[model samples]
Structure formats: structure tokens, C-alpha cells
Target: MSRAVLVEAPRPTIAAPAAAEETPAQRPSRRWRRAVSPVVLVVAWEAAARTGLLPAEKLPAPADVVAAGWRLTQEGTLGVHLADSVTRAAIGMLIGGVLALALGAAAGLLRLGDDLVDPPVQMARMLPHLGLVPLLIIWVGIGEELKITLVALGAFFPIYFNTYAGIRDIDERLVEAARTCGLGAAARLRHVILPGALPSIFLGLRLAIGAAWLSLVVGEQVNAQTGIGFLMMEARDFSQTDVVLLGLLIYALLGLASDLGLRIVERRVLTWRRGLRAT
Candidate 1:
């Protein structure tokens, strides 16, 4: 009996490797790396333009575009156009954002609301919103209303869809837990739902900002008296390629700046989330 007795040892557990920490010294290098591609592209473009490989008549060099922007700045027209564009965008965003939050919350939180609101919204979103320009022109005429309406329409869907999706995507268990904890509906919405939905909301916000700018560009082109789009149109009539290119560059920079700002806000708001990072 003793000779037949045997024993087994426990297996050793292995721990996962920790993520590599990024030092302060690495941050500047990382930022520099990000700038490399844009720098190279600009250099290549400038070289091509100088060599006549890229016709200046078609696409102006970066330096020429810079000069055009400087000239516009000196003329005082640039500041006025910039201010007008910002005001239009801000007004439209306010209108669109309010509507989106209301509709999206209703549709997301209430079964009856979803049944009533979702179908029309889904159908409407299927149509290219920008394609409504002609109809909008007739309905609102070529004025501030036309431009603001177009921007509002463009900004609406992204925020609405994202907000709806974000609220719906929240865990049922979390809602149940909140209920079990005897939290009121308002409290649950404020603490549990909105916080949980913020990531998607911010994503929508970023997208909406971009859509606002794009809509502004088109709206301003509808016999606009001022704005970057109008400036570009004026330049086109005069065959000023450099000014047109500068307008395009300004648009790109504005969009990029907006997206970056949103990203910073998102990171701050979602500090609890430990998302995967690109190496």
C-alpha cells in the first residue's frame, strides 16, 4: 500500500509581459517622426514644381501658397473671411448639436421613441445630404439661411447616429446594477449612460466638425460675398491658382486642428479607459 502511493506537483503560473513605458525623451522624437512624412511630401512637391514636373498653373508650390496667404492677410480681407466662416460654422453646430442630442437621446432611451423616430432618420441618412443643395437653395434662398441650413444638415446625422449607437451599446448589466442600487432614472442617465456613451459621442463630434467645414465650403460657394470659399471662387475667376491652393490648405489645417482638439478632449474625458496604443 505504501509503495503504491504517488504525488503530483502544481504547475507554475506565467505572468503577462508589461507594456513598454514611453519616456519623456521619446515624446519629442515621436512627434518629430509624425512630422517627417509631411515635410518630405512638401519638399518633393516644391522640387517638382520648380522642375516644371508639376505645372505651377495647375498646382502652386508651397512657398507661393504661403505668399498668397500672406498677401491676403496684409489686405485685411483674410481676417474678415475667417471670422465669417467661423461664425457660420459655430451657429450651425449649435443648432445641429442640440437637435442631435435631443433626438438621439429619445430614440436611444425609449422604445416608443425609437419606433417613432429611427425609421425616418435611417431613411433620410441614406440620401446624400450634400445632394440636397439645390432643394435647400430653393427652400431657403441664397443667403445666411441657406448656408446655415446646409451646415446644420451636414452636421446632424453623424452626431445623431453615434449618440444613438453609443447609448444602445452600453451594457445591460450596468443599467441593471444601477437600478438595483436604487439610482433614479435621471441619476442613471447622468452617471452611467452619458459617461459610458462619451467616447462615441466625441467620435461623432469630431466627424460633425469635419462635416460642418465641408458643408461651409459648399454653402459659401453659393454666391457668397465673403468666406474662404468665396475668396477661392474670386481667385478662380482671376486665375490665381496660388490663392485657391492657400484656401484648400487653410481648410485642411482647420479640419486637422479641430480633430486634434477633439482627440485631446476625448483622452481627458475617457481617462478611465485603457485603450490599446499604436507602437
Candidate 2:
């Protein structure tokens, strides 16, 4: 008994906690899984076109669309049209984005600004911006100005609405806390307000990008020159369904790419947020 009292029992071995199982959302292959349905749909479409179930004239086969794209590429026309479209989009986005940010900030931050700005913006937003194409044509003519203006209009409303909403929706307690911490108005805005509103702003940006593309489609179709929309219109005149479909495909791809890029930026910028996971 005395010898046992002098010795301490060996400590129980503790196995390291088993690693948590990876969920589908955590898997690297999740992105590839998302592509499966689209791939299947495309394959079914190709099969339908080959079997004459889907008329080629009505919706050209994917192969024909690819061929048309390759032909355009060979002729060097695709590069020019692509460049022109990209340039217009870039310029319009820049102009629209700047105006939206400035006005939205003013409206959101100041009571007088909100009273003055929100009413008119709300009224203007109610009018279908796309429906203003005729007025835009009259004001600016069917040239680069018309296209740029249309795109800018399309890009403006979403950003303006979202930015105002985002800033307004921020918790007052956070602002109060910043004030209590001896932070001035500018510091509070930079540290607390902008970060809190970023998610909504990004959402608005994505919507604006889509709208810009939609406006560009209409703008290019109306005008007399180089762009995917113009190419599609020209192909329509010639009954070149393949080329028309190819143009549509290009637009879809561009929109998708832009959204994807924005998403990456949003993720990087909002890393501090624990926002909902797709699961």
C-alpha cells in the first residue's frame, strides 16, 4: 500500500480527435460537378440536332455554331468586334459606376441628400430604362454615344439602389460604437460603413454588369457597325442561324466571365465576413 501510494498511475493516452469529414461543399471537385448538368444538356442538344428532332435553321447545332466562330476568327472580324464591344462596355461601366457611387453615398449619408435624391431616383427606376432606347436615339443618335449612354443607364439604377440600401441597412449600433471609440466621421465611414455595405454593393455591381450587357445587345442591334450584336443582326439578314447563335453564345460567355471575375473579387474583399456557405 505504501509503495502504491508513492507511484502515480500512468496518464491515460488521449488519441487526437478524428479529423472532420469533408462535405461536398468543401470538395475541390464541386465546381466540376456543377458543369455536369450543362454538359449533359449540350450533349442531348447535339444528339437532337443530329437526329433532326431539333431543326438546324431554328437553332443551329453546337458544331455549326463552333464552325461559324472559327470562320469569323479566321477572317479576323471576331477580334475587331470583340475589341469594340469590350471597349464600349468598359467605358460605360466606368462612367456609370462613378456616378452611382457618388450619388448613392450622398443620398445614404445625409438626410437632406436622401430626401432630394431618392425620390427622383425611385421615379426614374420605375421607368423601364431599356424602353428609353428611342429617346436615347433621338438625344444621342445611333452612334457610339447612343450605345454608351444606353449601357450607362442600364448600369446606373442597380448600383444606385443597392448602394443606398446597403448603407441604410447597416446596424446603427456599429456606428455608435465607432463614435464611442473616439473615431471621427471620416474614420467611422472608412472603417465601419464601407466594409459593412460592401456585400450589397457587390451584388448591385453584378446586376449592373448584366444590365449593361443587355443594353449593349439592344444598342449594337440598332446601330450600323461592329459588335457581336451587329454581327448577329447581319447574320439574321442572311439567315445565317449558326452565326447568330454563335454571337448569342459569345454574349452569354462574356456575361458569365464578368460575373465570375466579380465573384472572385467579392470573395477576396469580404474575407472577414462569415456569410452563408452554398453547402
- Counting clashing residue pairs in each candidate, in order, gives 0, 0
| Pairs of residues clashing in candidate 1 | none
State in Å the error of residue 38, model 2: 0.6
In angstroms, give how far residue 10 of model 1 lies from its true place.
Answer: 2.9
For all candidates in order, the CA lDDT equals 0.92, 0.91
**TM-score list, all predictions:** 0.96, 0.90
Give candidate 2 misplaced runs (Cα > 4 Å): 1-26
Candidate 2, residues 22-117, lDDT tens digits: the string is 677767687788899999999999999999999989987898899999999999999999989988898999899989998999999999999999
Q: Model 1, range 1-279, lDDT digits (tens) per residue?
A: 367756778889898977777889999999999999999999999999999999999998999999988998999989999899888988998899889988998999999989999999999999887899999888989999998998898889999999999999999999999999999999999999999999888888999999999999999999899999999999999999999998889889988988898899888889998877676
Residue 115 lDDT in model 2?
95
The 10-residue segment of model 2 with minimum total lDDT is 1-10
